[model samples]
Target: MTRDAGQMPEELERAQRFAWDMESLYGDDLVSVVLYGSAARGEYRRGASDLNVMVLVRELTPAALRRAGQRARDWVAQGNPTPLMLSHDEWLRSADVFAIEVADMREAYHVLAGADPFAGITVDPADLRLQCEKELKGKQILLREQYLLFAGEPAELGGLLVRSFSTFLVLFRTVLRLSGEAGVRDAEEVVLKVAARAGFNPGALLEVHRARASGQPPRPTADSPLAVGYLDAVDRVVTYVDRLVREGGAQA
Candidate 1:
């Protein structure tokens, strides 16, 4: 089963145990087990973060899936998200379509067992751009819709900002990569850089993060400048990415 903590050591131990379990369970069929996302990047927060793992097997059959289902439930029961299960062939085949997530995995990951699964795989640049444009535009629409529902609800508005903040950072990093930029992983730094690039102030985004770190959830008033800035920053990122010179870049 999975377990999380207010600290890091024990969490790492849990990941290690998971790796050992998978190695034993699948043996040679197990291509690799990797710990990725915030946990692998050293940015995991005790109560807010999840331990994301990637598992690759030689092949995926009904029997393999059945086995995974059994172990996935065990892992999820312990408060961890289900591991990303992929077959070696599927991993290579779906590279382009899944580039955005694979990009993050390449950015930071700890190999638990076997060799790195991404070692020789390639993600098409065109596919990455297509996904980014699609995702940003979709999120922009969702934000507008969510704002309507939360417009008069201060606490909920703040919670929306608090919740989606990290997700935007990941999007921002991928956007920056699209612009040939790299090496800025800190949340504050990423916000500031992306805001400047996409033409928005970082104040509101920074404020939401501060509130979360203070151990008190921020409840920004519906019309508060912080709330307005939060929406504007994301809106501008959508616009900026849409204007990039690539196929499907400008979605009307």
Candidate 2:
């Protein structure tokens, strides 16, 4: 069972109850219904975050997939992202390809039902670093394209900055971990520390964070000081990640 559902918000409590329903539906075949990501890490924000769950089962047969699919759709209807449904064996074998995800989940997760599927799991730091590099580079290209698409409209650009800043935060945390800074989890603090270490000004990221927290537009217009600073901050981060990748070399 999960740590008292009453401790969570109503939406999360309802999601936990739904996981329990899955346990009843699958019985012995269901290995676990685990809560991961922001909610499990105790940093969840109501109406702004996802309830990420993983449903592991012993088998991945067609019948099992169908049942899990239906349940996942129902869960999505309740405003949660579709749960990751995998067999126990598959989950055990995916560590190499999913090192970053595995490490994050291993750091903090709640076992909502059945056995703990992630227990004793280990992720390779080399694999994690490589993936982080790839993700950072890929995201930088995508961010440039997205900025071009929405830079004309101040509201859209501001919204883009607010929404995509989280992705940058995730990468910042990963880079910090790769650089031997452990147990640093707060998103804003991570950005600040990373900026200081990487020798880039964090004023822009801080402004965006404050605006995001206050539920306001990032700035009056894309040509405004905040938007320009935000783009510069993002560009500097991209350069930082690129340098790390070059230094780490291709050894994964």
Candidate that scores best on lDDT: 1
lDDT of each: 0.80, 0.78
Q: What is the lDDT of residue 169 in candidate 2?
A: 77
> For residues 1-252, what per-residue lDDT tens digits would candidate 2 score against the true structure?
455888877756866897887887789999998888778767777666679889888998999888767767788887888888899999999888987778767767888888988777877777878888788778778877878888788788888888887778777777777777755777678888888767777887888777776777564476777777777776776677668777873222
Q: Per-residue CA lDDT of candidate 1, range 1-252, in tens?
A: 133333547667778778888887889999999999888878777777788998999988889878768778888998999988889888888868877788867888888888888788766667778888788778778877888899888888877877787777788888887777755677788888888889999999899887776656787777889988888888888888877844343211
TM-score for all predictions?
0.90, 0.89
Q: Candidate 2 — worst ten consecutive residues by lDDT sum?
A: 243-252
